[model samples]
Target: MLPPRLNDGGRTDLDLATLRRATFGLKLGAGVTLISLAIVEKLANPEMARAMLEQEPLLNLLAPFGVSADAFAVVAGSVELLLGLLVISGALPQVVAILTAVPFTATLALFGATEFLGHLPLYGVLLSFLVLGSLEETSHSLSGLRRRAGVPTH
Candidate 1:
């Protein structure tokens, strides 16, 4: 059932343009944070990063894949750097958001509830980008869906 607040007058009161701008800001911030962490923790202080990754069950999880914590750190860091750049550049943001979610989901699965709560904000950001699609578009897939259902996107 549609929420009464959202279903008022067969149109949403939400301002999608503002929502899009907010999502972009969040995506950019997440990208910068990823870049900084990659450089400082993984690329610059590799030994310390490896030590951190070597913690118990996480280390055990990597064993079956034949990936040492050191190698994983380097590779993961490189991926983070690349994804961060892509995100900041606004290149295929939806794809980047999905890719970013993989690691977040894996971490949540590995570490459980605490990590889930910690990452909720990030999850919301990614979800917003995904739902909103390209900021440049006047109407996105979700809007199309709404239109099909005879709902006003605006």
Candidate 2:
């Protein structure tokens, strides 16, 4: 019981539209939650972040470079906060997703399998958003604003 315009080639374009909107809404909610969590974990509990960094075995390599673990924690937390905002913005999903994965990749390498397994689901979710979100659907970001203002996406 579907209209012809929505039932092309035996596929329900209407159903696909519903699915897309549902998934997008889920991603948006997830992005907001992530932003809030990152702020709390990284910014509010910076000592905890530094302690976690101290637990990383690979910090040994950076010690010779005089890298202060506390400072690194602050920088990392700031970057995480920014990336969390980017995720919520939904601009250039592919680029944002890839950037968001970088810290986790470092964490996996530095902290080993436990860390990787803990964050694997996050990576998977980001990948899913990147793969499923179409560029045309990203009209709520700064880039989108620029586009609406007659500026180039670049």
Candidate 3:
């Protein structure tokens, strides 16, 4: 059940263009926050960091990225957090979301591809799909940013 707002801006009509920006923006923020937090914990304490990354499937794939488990956790986490906040607060969410996601998506997809090529398994593919599918959230945030930036909606 969806919660109704009392303000009453009757029959919500969502513009597809606006929806795309909003979705993209939110996804970027969430992803960045998640990654950044993980990296922070790993950096603060090596042992605890090791233990944390051990549970994430990404640990096994870290070697190809040239970052050690501890380093990978810390780096990935910090980067994600920073990126997430930027996406959420950027002045041009629509443009930023599209710009950032392109590289972000490529990095993940490349890693996934490397995993596949290295004979890892199906997990990489699944992770890639998950990462790619979340772009809609990025779009949402981007839409808000776009409106805030005075970008015209279709």
Candidate 4:
């Protein structure tokens, strides 16, 4: 299928359908990872959460708020869990993607180059989500193709 033309009357060969599928995969992957990490830090291994809070950057960030490390950990975990659920559910994905990006960007800034390099793949996915917006139902799937071709399904 020929790619659609842009509003500016410019033409390109980008396969939007394939791009959307790739974005969905990225979103699902990030969501699952976030949920799993949240569960592990908050429940499966509380000690790890405590140790994470002891990191210099986190300590500095939390110092002004007078919030206890444990409390911060709980709140952070809860936020991650909620964000993961929202992302996976495809609820306001563009907005959720931005929301997710804020903290991720902050963490990258806080930790500097090492983290920035390590999280390059995640950054790409987040950028793709921001640019692509929400995933819409497309008629390119097998079921849709079959329906379009007047094929009977049992």
Candidate 5:
């Protein structure tokens, strides 16, 4: 059974546009926080960042191909940074969200139930963004970064 708050107050006069805008803002905040933490972990603590990749299953798989732990950390950090910018700007949000969830999902498999439980809310946010699709207005995102960059909003 869904929570009572999940319903639209059982009202027919709900403003869906406002609801969507609010959700988008929420997603933006969540994405920014997640990315900021990742950048901090990557930039502030190189040893710990490399150690995390070393502990993941991906390292075992990629090690055979000569991908070192440090290399993996650098690559992962770069991808996260790029995806973080796209997500914050609301550019290709669905794609960005899916990409964002890949590492979280991997962590679930690598670390088991505890990690899964911890990241469940983040996974939910990513899934929500995927289902909600892209935002209609790009101007409100990143102070019109897309427009300023000559990127097509559509």
Candidate 6:
């Protein structure tokens, strides 16, 4: 039989199902990487945590809040790992993924920003950007401003 035709009647840039599935894989893989780093940097190293705070005058300014480096690292790192898993694995819906990316994205922006704003280290920020871009790119694959309506095209 002849191959199927490419209908020009408002077709998508790519197949919706294909995009969704691929996005899920991306979300999961990147999430795992991020979680792993968060654990190592935040959970395992108190000195590193202190260094993070000390590195940023803005962050240090907040020290009056009486937050210990270890405590801050534990909470921040654990949350990043947890959210990363959820986003990458699609354990949560697209909505949750979007919400999760907000913090993740900001984290990346902070890292990227520090290079100029604070002119501090670059490695940490670079890693954060990698994870952030992966996670964001995965879910942001959602197409169309509005949902298409047709015969339940699944």
Best by TM-score: 5
TM-score of each: 0.67, 0.65, 0.38, 0.67, 0.68, 0.53
Writing each residue's lDDT as its tens digit, candidate 4 over 47-142 gives 777787776546335657887777777777888888887766655656877898777788776688998897687677566665555323322221
* C-alpha root-mean-square deviation, candidate 5: 6.1
- Candidate 5 per-residue lDDT, tens place, 10-117, comes to 544324455545556765777687678667877556788777766664644467788877666667777777766666676566777788888778766667999899
Model 1 steric clash pairs: none
lDDT of 2 by residue, 1-154 (tens): 2334544566654454454465556566667766776777667787776777667646433556786776666666677777877776667777888888876787666668998888877888687667655444443332233235675655
Number of clashing residue pairs, candidate 2: 0
lDDT of each: 0.68, 0.65, 0.50, 0.65, 0.65, 0.54
Tens-place lDDT per residue, model 6, 68-129, is: 66667777777777876565545434455455555545554457765445422223323433
Q: For candidate 6, give the lDDT.
A: 0.54
Per lDDT, the best of the predicted structures is 1
Q: What's the count of clashing pairs in each model shown?
A: 0, 0, 28, 0, 0, 2
Error of 6 at 142 (Å): 9.1
Taking the tens digit of each residue's C-alpha lDDT, what string does model 3 give over 1-154?
1224556754344555654554454445455554455555655566776785576545435678676786766665565556556544544444544544543454455467664454332233224334434555434343343344575544
lDDT of 5: 0.65
Q: Distance (Å) between predicted and true CA of 23, model 3?
A: 9.3
Candidate 6 at 33: error in angstroms? 2.0
Q: Which portions of model 4 miss their true places by more than 4 Å? A: 1-23, 57-63, 134-154
Instruction: Give me the overall lDDT of model 2.
Output: 0.65
